[model samples]
Target: MHHSGERGERPAIREKSRGIWRTVTWRELAEEAAALAAAASARGLQRGAHVALLGDNRPRLYAAMCAAQWLGAIVVPLYQDATADEIASSIESAKVTHVFAENQEQVDKLLEILPRCPTVRCIVYDKDRGMRHYKQPELVSYASLLQQGRQLAAEKRDFLQAEAARGTGQDSAFVFFTSGTTGPAKGVVLTHASLIDRARVAAATESLKDTDVAMAYLPPGWIGQNLFSYVQPMVVGYCVCCPESSETMLADMREMGPTYFLATPRVLEALLTQVTMRMEDTGGFNQRLYRAGMAAAHRIDAGKTVSLSDRITAAACSLLIYGPLRDVLGMSNVRVAFTAGDAAAPALVTFFRALGINLKQLYGSTETGFFVAMQRDGQVKPDTVGPVADGVELKFTEQREILVRSPGMFKEYHRDPETTAQARNADGWFHTGDAGYLGDDGHLRIIDRIKYVGALNDGTAHSPKLLENKLKFIPYIKEAVAFGDGRDMVCALIDIDMAAVGRWADKRSISYTGHADLASQDEVYELIAEGIAKVNADLAQEPALAKSQIHRFVILHGELSPDDGVLTRTGKLRRGVIAERYRALVDAMYGGAKEVRIDVEAGHADIKVRDAEIIGHRQIRSAA
Candidate 1:
């Protein structure tokens, strides 16, 4: 509303539909939000009410959030793809009475869970598809809601304005659910001041302006996405463009050419995998050129330029190769791209910077309102998440767990002050739970979770999560789990990428029935072995991690998924669950057995352990 008063006619939100961009100016956005607020208020919505929004990055969804917040309601954004059971906990915890669902799919999920969540009084749906048959009294279309809102506004214009004005800086704005590796998601509460203050600080630090634009492609449930798309844009008055759907996200990003972009490590790795596969499919000449250009780019990224000829060749390669590659990946116009959520491979980070993209790392979580540390331009390092963010107080615990006290830190863990107390200290420093150190260069370098990372029996440092992340950078490997916490050597359980390895197999005429069949294939194992070899080579270059290189690995029969309880809703591996489920396979990998029993049905595919090829094919006998 503030922006609307200042720049009412400027584009605030843009949504792609039917291959065309549909924009909503600041004035229109404010009007729609106000209307929704008036309508909800007319239906008994009040300040401090909890509102659940289930959808992707839709313009209407953002408007819905604004409307809810305007009435002093705490917005709880659920992952659009979450199942009924997955969201039932959050819905019950927040006592969400009003749900703004994106479409029939989301509405259906809500309907399935409504019996368990009887507090839901209204379900406002945006799309009308497949909704004609529904007879639920709680269901209402968004258009109808707006119509009611318009009527109320005509009679009582000041009502909505007064409601919006009642909101205070300390009022709770959002309740973000963090899906940790092993828990029911925790609802993190953030106040309006905490969220807006950090957004402004980051906006100023980055020199962002109203002219800048960004794509909201990832799941809005993530706090990082909420900050980058919803919170920051409101603070900076920048336009946020949403893609039509997940399938068209890349094409939309390429078309919109968003000035600012944020991607998770998984997203970045997927883009690189696409580039890798495309190059592998091209002619020999193009493939050779890509390799040479990337080699030169790597040299350039490392600041190892030697001669004038090197500079000339690299510049020509950028024009001929990297430039087109950037365009295809929809990052050509991206000014400052960021990667977060999880640790990214150093090589992967360097890969983009080599191509002249200002790719940097961000370190934070849902608890920090998603801004704790960030890499600044020209101060970027592959291994660090730059320095602590501006206006943030940071320190280290005795165990080296990163502790931060930032303006953006969450107010509390909703309804769980005991857990909150365990995380945040009396002095306001929130324990990040991540073990890391601040180097002399003032950059924060993360190793892994304090409890999950330790030393091997030989006293060599072991960080399985870090090792797993690096191995996953290989296009052929989708997920890897490292073991040998107190053992002499590290071993890994692997999950192959169905699309990537399938395409590779098709090109080579390798026969396979399914993911399980592919894993059982000798050739597929060899391919994965080759990928691990490359990871080992890269590890050899890093003195601190070389001793912890993967000694043996077995490709599982299938991918880890949330449905199977092996992965969380946000796709984080449930290590304890996986270890327990595949105890036999783990034993076989360490016992030097040639094979382990497993189940592979049409849907349920468990770990299919085969003899893990040793690093040098020397065959690992049971390590006693």
Candidate 2:
């Protein structure tokens, strides 16, 4: 609201609607929030009431959240891609009374679960498509909500401001739900002061300017996205652009050319795969040029360049290849590229650095308001997420589990005192559940989830996430599930990135129908086996992890989605569920079978039956 008076015309948020970009000024955003706050007050929403925001990244949703906080209400954003059942648990857990859904699909999910969730009395929808036939009493369009809000604002001129005055710094602002990778999602309650303080720290760390632009495409439910896109932008007075849809993310990123970028390890991997596939498809001079350029860049990155000839080669490569590639990836203007959501593979992070992009890593979680440790510019390390942020202290337990004390720490887990107590102690140290140690350089190096870190049958240490990150860094592989716990040897179920492998196949004129067909091909098996072999070769150097090398593997015939109970809505693997669901394949790999009869339903789509090659010591073929 202060920004509105300071710079009313400044663009606060931008969104692409129906192929055209639209901007909302700071002044307009403040009015919408204030009016919505007034209208929500009329709807019986008060301080401490929980309001739910559901859908993709949109300006209206951001306005609604601000409106919610204007009235001292708590905002809970549910992942747009989450199933109705998954959303129901979140709505029920928060006892959400009012929900602002982005579109009909989100509103429909709310209505479907409304009968069971009696507290949800009002549903405000942003877009009215496919909503004309609905005659639900709880349903109201965003247009209507705004009209009502304007009327209420006119009637009670100081209503919203008065309510805002009652809000305290200690009051809860958001309740971000955990990803539920291992169990049910827990509502992590964070306060206004906490998020605001951390946002400022992050902004100061980056020296963020009002001229800087960021794109918001990730789920609002994820704290990492919320922090970078919503909270930090608000604090730093930067413009956050929301893409039209997930399908248009890359195109939008190219068009907008944001100066700041944040993405998951998965997103980065996919982008790299896309670039690699594109390069491979052109397989002539361009392919040779890219390879030669990358080799020079790698040498430059390792400080192995000693001759003027080497420097000249690298500079030429930068002009011919790296510069154009960065422009194509829409990262040429990116000042600070951040990756979180799972510590990315060191190799993956270094790839962009080699291309002259300042890609860095951040180590934090939902419970920490998303800022604990972040790499500073010019001091980034591929293996470490930099030293702790200002006002944050980090320590490690005897077991190497990381603990943190940050000003941005969560207040508690909403209605889950026991879990909250377990997470934080009397000393105010928050147990991060992540296991890692500090490097001599004073940077934090995270390995994997403390509980998920385990050993093979021979007691050789194995970290599934580390291995999975390494696999995902491979262009052909997408998601991997490593199984070796109490087993004779490590075996993996590989999910081939359809787009990447499909492109490779298409480039070779290899005919295939769908994902299952492509995955079942012997050539695809050879590509995946090649990736695994490279990973094993790397692991062989580390004696402790040598035995943890994957000796056998099988390709998954279908995607592991949330509906299948094998993956959480946020893409975290339910390892137990996956292991049991793919028991036949897992057994076959260990049973010395040459192939596994993969029979898994493709998430309410169809029953897929395919034979997946169990590539082992004898079956593994060298990539041609």
Give the candidate number with the greatest TM-score. Answer: 1
* CA lDDT, candidate 2, residue 498: 88
Q: Compared with the true structure, what per-residue lDDT tens digits does model 1 show for residues 138-249?
A: 9999999998987787665777768767879999999999876755679999999999998998898789999999999888888888889999989999999999988898
Report every candidate's CA lDDT.
0.85, 0.85
Cα distance off (Å), candidate 1, residue 126? 0.9
- For each candidate in turn, the TM-score is 0.96, 0.95
lDDT agreement of model 2 with the native: 0.85
lDDT of 1: 0.85
lDDT of 2 at 3: 80
Residues forming the 10-long window of minimal summed lDDT in candidate 1: 615-624
Q: Write the per-residue lDDT of candidate 2 for residues 43-98, one digit (tens) a residue.
A: 88888999999999999999999999998999999899888988899889999999
lDDT of 2 at 468: 87
Per-model clash counts, in order, read 0, 0
Task: State, as a TM-score between 0 and 1, how close model 2 is to the true structure.
Answer: 0.95
